[model samples]
Target: MKRIGMLTQIFIGFVLAIILGVIFGPSIAVVQPLGDLFLRLIKFIVVPLVLASLITGITSLNNVNKLLSLGGKTIVYFLATTFFAVLIGLAAGFILSPGKGVDIALPTESAEKAEAPGITETLLNFIPVNPFESLTNGNILQIIFIAIAIGIAITTVGEKAKPLADFFEALAQVMYKITGFIMKLAPIGIFGILAPIVGNYGLDILLPLLKVILAVAIGCLLQVLVTYSIAVRTLGKMSPLAFIKGIAPAGIVAFTTASSSGTLPVTIKNTQENLAVSKEVSSFVLPLGSTINMDGSAIYQGVAAVFIAQFFGVDLSMGQIVTIAFMAVVVSIGAAGVPGAGLIMLTMVLQSVNLPLEGIALIAAIDRILDMFRTSTNVIGDASAAVVVQHQENKASLAKSA
Candidate 1:
């Protein structure tokens, strides 16, 4: 038999895992340790990867103006795509009305509140008290901040920084190799991670809120397929099909793992190798995008907020819908790049529109299932943004040369 591609292997493994999960039930959970090991391995290398790649990319630029310009463009693209995602989510919720006929029992107590840090607090936290501490905590945003600062400082130091810059460049290369090694285990890891989830929940949990789940899934697909495609085609001036094909590996990993950070290594590698985006752009944009470019979560928040309101038979005013959109954009920025971080941010969105906090309990059961889709969407958005920004930078460079 001809060899199957890695993507096909992962997809097959995923489908079989679900089948076995439905048949074997939670007994399939025995292999969960393999998944946990995969997650741990990814997490183990992320900090160093981000640290080395960002610093090396930034220092290599050797031009503060270019760095700032790229940063501005990246942030603008992220915000714009995120806003579009929110609008898509709102449309999905309004059209699908996922919560209209559902009657789920509210929990006795509210879901454990994972209060998102205030905007001001989040900004302040970016400046780490000790950079080493941030590394230890695996604080991605903070690490990016510190990495850029170090890179800027290196640029100012001129020739004196060559050794340090080369050292980090080498480190980044090493991490990429290590990432490849870890990714070899992806099919097994995906099986291990997904089997238990499908086994535990089965179709039973899905029946009650199937509409809501479908709405979220549809919204995510629209964002990735429609919204990001437009950006890639028009803005990035690249083939949408090519862009999707290039990022497929990262997207698959993101789907299986349901983590932006967990899939970062794969994302960076694919962006650089497959998409041919410069390391400078991929390193800076992908990491920043992972932290803040949560188009998928924003879409989910819009859908969930509206679903919750509809479930409770509450008619939201135009003002409340607008508030949900605004809050979704803002809260998603502070959302951590981990599994289920969006749930906490969803609480804030619920409160913005005077929706009941208890509504979260209704969706909590299947959040993981939905998370897998949204997380994949988020990674795609990040990769798309990187491609767009890289195109813009190349155009600018060509114009300057002319």
Candidate 2:
């Protein structure tokens, strides 16, 4: 038989896993370790991949001003898209009202409460007290900070830094090669990760929350299809269809994994190779986006917050809606790229608007399914942002030449 493509293989595995889970039920739990191993393998390379790729990308810029300009544009695009994502989510929540008639009893386990740190503290935390500690802790923001600092230092030191820069450049290449080897195992990994989820949760758990799930799904689709498309076409001057097709590989992996961070290697590869975004751009934009961009998470938060409020018959004032919107944007920035990180941030968003924290129990069961779609959307947003930024840079370069 002719060999199946990787994407096709993953789809088949996903379908089979779900079917087996449904037919065999908890007996399929035996496959859970396969999934855990896959996750562990992905997590194994993330810190190093990010650290090496980021430092290499920054040093390659060779100009401090360009680095700063790219950073500014990337952040602007991220924040703008994120703000729009929140609005879209809120609109979907209001219209769909997923929480209406959700009569499920709140779980007996109390919701874990975590206070949102002050903005100043968040900013300060970005700078690692000890770079080694940051790496050991897998503190992504701190690692990015140290990487940028080291990259800039290499640039400032001029000729003296070339050897170090060259070393990291080589390191990045090796890491990419390693990533390629890891991705060859993606089909198996995806199967391992998804099988247990299907087996344990099954369709029954998802039935009651179907409306809320559908609302969040639609909202995420809108952000990815409509919002990002408009930005790419109008600002980036690129065909959105082409953009979407190019990033599909990464999107597939993201959906299966439900992890932006775990899917980083694939995202970076697709953005660089398929999307034709420059390595310098893809390397910096994607890793940073993975760390900070939470468009999908922001949307989920908006939808969930409203869903919970409506479920409890708590009337939200106009001011409260505005607060939720603002909180969605803020909390999303702090959300890690791991699976279910968005749910953790949801607590902060709920608390901001004084929604019942226990309301989380209502939808916790189906979060995995919801997370798959949201993570895919998040990866698409990151890839799209990189393309848009690159397009603008080319336009500026041409204008300067003309």
User: Which numbered prediction scores highest in TM-score against the true structure?
Assistant: 1
Estimate, for each residue in 1-402, the C-alpha lDDT of model 2 and write its tens digit.
128866677677777887887888878878877777777877888899899899988998898998999999999999999999999999999999988887777777645555656668888999988899999988888989988999999988989989999998888898899888887777777777777777778777688788888989999999988999999999887799988877887887898888898889889988887778888888899999997998988889999999999999998999999999999999888888888888778887888878888888776767778889889989999999999998988887799899
With a 3 Å backbone cut-off (N, CA, C), the pairs that clash in candidate 1 are: none
Model 1, 369-395: lDDT tens per residue?
889988999999999999999999999
Score every model by TM-score: 0.98, 0.96
The number of the candidate with the highest lDDT is: 1
Provide the overall lDDT of each model, using Cα atoms, as 2-decimal numbers.
0.90, 0.86
Q: On a 0 to 100 scale, what is the lDDT of residue 79 in model 2?
A: 97
- Cα RMSD for candidates in order: 1.3, 1.6
TM-score of 2: 0.96
Badly placed stretches (over 4 Å) of model 1 are none
Model 2 is weakest, by summed lDDT over 10 consecutive residues, at 110-119
